[model samples]
Target: MDFDRKQLTNEQLLDLYKKLLKPRLIEEKMLILIRQGKVSKWFSGIGQEAISVGVTAVLHKDEYILPMHRNLAVFTGRDIPLYRLFSQWQGKANGFTKGRDRSFHFGTQEFKIIGMISHLGPQLGVADGIALAHKLRNEGKVTAVFTGEGATSEGDFHEALNIAAVWELPVMFIIENNGYGLSTPTNEQYRCENIADKGIGYGIESHIIDGNNILEVYTKLDALATSMRENPRPVLLEFKTFRMRGHEEASGTKYVPQELMDMWAVKDPVTNYREYLKTEKVLTDEYDEALRAELKKEIDEHYQQASAEPAIEANLSEELNDVYKTYVFEEVNSKSNSENVRMIDAISQGLKQSMERHDKLVIMGQDIAEYGGAFKITDGFVAQFGKDRVRNTPICESAIVSAGMGLSINGYKSVIEMQFADFVSTGFNPIVNYLAKVHYRWQENADVVVRMPCGAGVQAGPFHSQTNEAWFTKTPGLKVVYPAFPYDAKGLLATAINDPNPVMFFEHKALYRSMYQDVPTDYYTLPFGKASLIKEGDDVTIISFGAGVHWALETLAKKPEINADLLDLRTLQPLDMEAIFTSVKKTGKAIILQEDTLFGGIASDIAAMIMENCFEHLDAPVKRVGSLESAIPFTKALEDQYLPKARFETALAELIAY
Candidate 1:
């Protein structure tokens, strides 16, 4: 059969063959290393080289591609140094992740490659973010993300595709249908005859192609990417192929049928492509053999150099250093002009001021755009900043948060709001796994602020009334800020947005319209890790944040004779330990209050820290006041009893008297 190069020249055709053969050679070498115990593990992409190579060949250098564990050619085809890749595989200090993660779990921003998380589906939403950034900037850059057929069952896949289609962002949702996801076959994965048909539900153009055929893969992607760049829109391309190996080297392939393996072996992409190149006169058999030899030599030399590099040192401080970006807080001038503003308006003003200052700041939520959000915090934002800056997302928390991380990847700051804090559970995986760990793992900051309206008082039931700040305070890489007053709310929010780390900004829904304060009219920022001294006295110390601050104040106002130090811990993650210890030592008595339930609450941690640090200065035992350990009831009467308001008042009285 005569080879039809189509629009590709002879040089391009030969280059594709070289790209296809390199990963196959690299995988073969890696398998040997695995057996020799030089390499720990590998997700071999032996038979599936054509999909990554052909797709990467069609993409521009500036365009981004998020590759999964099985897409090794995407890295090699992009001309990333072999030494660096080998260094990563060998757990060397010179690797992309500094030996923090194994296999292809790390990404390099220089190469425009976003590595996939183990979840397998969140990267699709991240692709939506990168594509959104390109669309927002009119960059004409396209993003391609890969996933196996089994990951199609994930909600993130559907959410990301729906978001990309709705926004008309230039993205290629590449599904490498490699027969099985781990041990489960594609037949058990989904009911649809073709994964491409799932794209129809999302309004995205879909196609199924012969993934083993390099010419078909390259030609189709080239035309599709060209059209997408010219007129931005998302499309789905399902590549029918087989995984040729186990999920990982250790898993083994006993679950796969013998006939299936034999059938795919004959249709091997690398061997077939090599034979085609020879038949087309692009290379002789001798030249092909020489090329393979040269590539093997190069891989061997690179591996040797990488193996000689130093391994990661076990330094405790160094290991903890890059978890968050160091932020220098500029003290706001206290004498700045002030005006009375509600907590909601204060947050709105802070967001408005931030949007005005940072051109790249984007706000995303379900009803935030024209609907003004659930609390009406951004009532007129869409009218002022337009829809692009204030994007209304679907009811997909996982995708929205993942997209926020994506926007941060390309030098943009994003603020993602959960309608109510309770709904954040839907977005929990991305927040804890990807957003929190990206900086620690790869030295890349996911500069995102997730505004969670938390706490209970309005009888909104179990779902909407959760005070889940404790959920993330235990997370290492995230910064947790829960403000009590309008002044602190505005200032802390400004700081959270400016800081180069993921922040969980908890806004108590009960405090939105209830509290009013004289806040700074102009832009200002309050430093984190500092507690706000709401009131100063000498008898007892009351430590709290968010709605607990108000309850403490109410209790303190009623007891004029009982002088107390009211400390509003503005940020939870960067807990004001110094302030806490100082107040606890001075008073020699402390009562920690929280809106969350008593068991496993942040208040318990605070109480423990107080006892640990201020054990010597103990006039009385440390006391904790929190809501009952039960789901927040829907009735106002039960809610009042369930809340910590009465409990806090009693605890403060007992502490003062003791």
Candidate 2:
């Protein structure tokens, strides 16, 4: 599309100028706030406001925006009130996050803008999910996700772009080439001439434009946005500009050369745009003066009013609230037995039943379609639910989790599966940083379940076998469930999918086909944060979860004289503290067992909780039994030695003797 001044009327041009000017002026005032010690930091969007404003102009009022910290003009162009922006910066009680987060890292559903994370690249994949949902719903909406040239080097950039391209999602991936990423120059980062060139490999249309040229930015983005809405294709756009100030008000920026700064100073976007408006006779001198006065007075008044508003007081209870959504499922007739089933079969049945109950529920993972997910857990799902709902995603962990959250944001329940537990490290950023924090940040429903095949008894080596539930147990706003028996696995999994929160569901790979139990055929949901007592006794209490529960139960069975009370914790995050306390108070001695490494494992946490609550009832110190700190080996001999039944039995006997 060629830039033609005749395309837009003078009034439209003047309106675009105001959108560009508001953020520039607001940032100037923000810099003053930093200097006055009111704000701790400021990421100035001084020279790049034109690009964000132009992109936002092309988007509809309800279109979603995934913006970074430097794109303040997006809020202005999206019609978020200036006073709210000021209130957010001032840390007032009326801020978007209730003053929980500072700076540009807060978003509200009303504005359709996602709060930015400092990592800068994870949200692009999330944007892909939102676009995917819009396409599925036949909604004529597009998502614009902003990032920097430096962030494009991150792995998340490729994962997001590749999936978006392969799915033909309606997303506009815009990169702001501001010469430097924090302090590193673009030349030092990548040898490519343009970041948009990378988009060609994914079969996406790429565009390069001068970000300082407001007309070019607006015209190019407007054309792409219009075309993508109908055609449903991802677009990558790179806009060249420069950062006029330090990375933040507190950053020294000594590495930036004075000569380069001087060169960019001569081409300031705000000054250039004003000059162009005047040259086109779009703004008379008197009109310009009055516009400037009006903007200055409004901004000053907003800042003063926002600053005077009461600061949010520290509230421990409120901070802990809204972490998890409370869900209620009706109870059916209680039954201890119905028909024998394997763990794998029970899981597949549970998933099938849940999907049948909820029409909007979706399941996505690698090779989960006809391939049945590496483990054949979803063998007949595609035939039943169709390929649209049982999506087979690319080999990208971050994209899998992020896209699931995106779908959840658009009112769909997603069950995302990580192929193996050890592979979760690749997708940890989105899981820990974004999905786990989504509910707390804006009280949004992150109604997604991430299933991980875990445990080490399979001899699949370090790459496949792992028990990493302890990592998620420490993270707030996530529910971690690991069931030991087939009945528990089926019942708990049904609850996990129905409940409205992000759940990290760990399924022990070794227990899938090896364990068999009579599970109820009827639909049911087990209560979260409650434990199941496998055996009742009074000499000692054994607490375990997942595969370790079987190990401990067997150990106790062999030693009949111990008279142990065995407890199986179904959920790790919402732990059954009451169950632990009751059993500990009865038996007086306790043992905690797990399949993860001994140090920093769930066993340590259970031991700590027992001591904290049952100090007076204890007859001996709490004992923890788990695998050694070394990684799981490949050979059967070494793997057996690493996680041996003898280790657990020995620990159990020691606690009994003491």
Q: Estimate each model's TM-score.
A: 0.98, 0.97
lDDT at 317 for candidate 2?
81
Model 1: residue 496 alpha-carbon error in angstroms: 0.9
Please state the error at residue 480 of candidate 2 in Å. 0.5
Alpha carbon deviation, residue 283, candidate 1 (Å): 1.3
Residue-level lDDT of model 1, residues 1-658, one tens digit each, is 1235797888988889999989999999989998999988889998899899988999999889999998999999889999999999887887898778988898889999999999988999999999999999998888999998989899999999999999998999999998998999888888889999998898889999889889889999999999999999999999989888899999999999999999999889888877887777888989888999999999999998998887778878878988887777767655578999899999999999999989999999999998999899999999999999999999999999999999999789999999999999999999999999998888889999999999899999999899998889989999999999999999899999999899999999899999999998989988999998889988999999998988888887898998889999999989899999998889888888898998898888888888788899989999988899899999999999999898777777777778
List, residue by residue over 1-658, the lDDT tens digit for candidate 2: 1235658898888998888888888888888888889887788888888789999999998889989899999988887777888888777876787776778886677889886778877889889888888988889789999999999999999999999988889999989999998899999999989999999889999999988888888887888899888888999999989888888878866889999888888777778778887887887779878888899999998888887898788898888876665567554443445789999888988888899988889899999999988999999899999988899988999987888888887778999988998888999988888888877776777888999999888889988888899889989989999999988888889889988889999999999999999888767778789999989999998888988888887777788788888899988988989999999999999988888888998788889988998999999999988887798999999999999467989878777788
Task: List clash counts for every candidate, in order.
Answer: 0, 0
- Report lDDT per candidate: 0.91, 0.86
- In terms of lDDT, the best-performing candidate is 1
* Local error of candidate 2 at residue 426 (angstroms): 0.4
**Candidate 2 error regions (>4 Å):** 1-3, 325-337
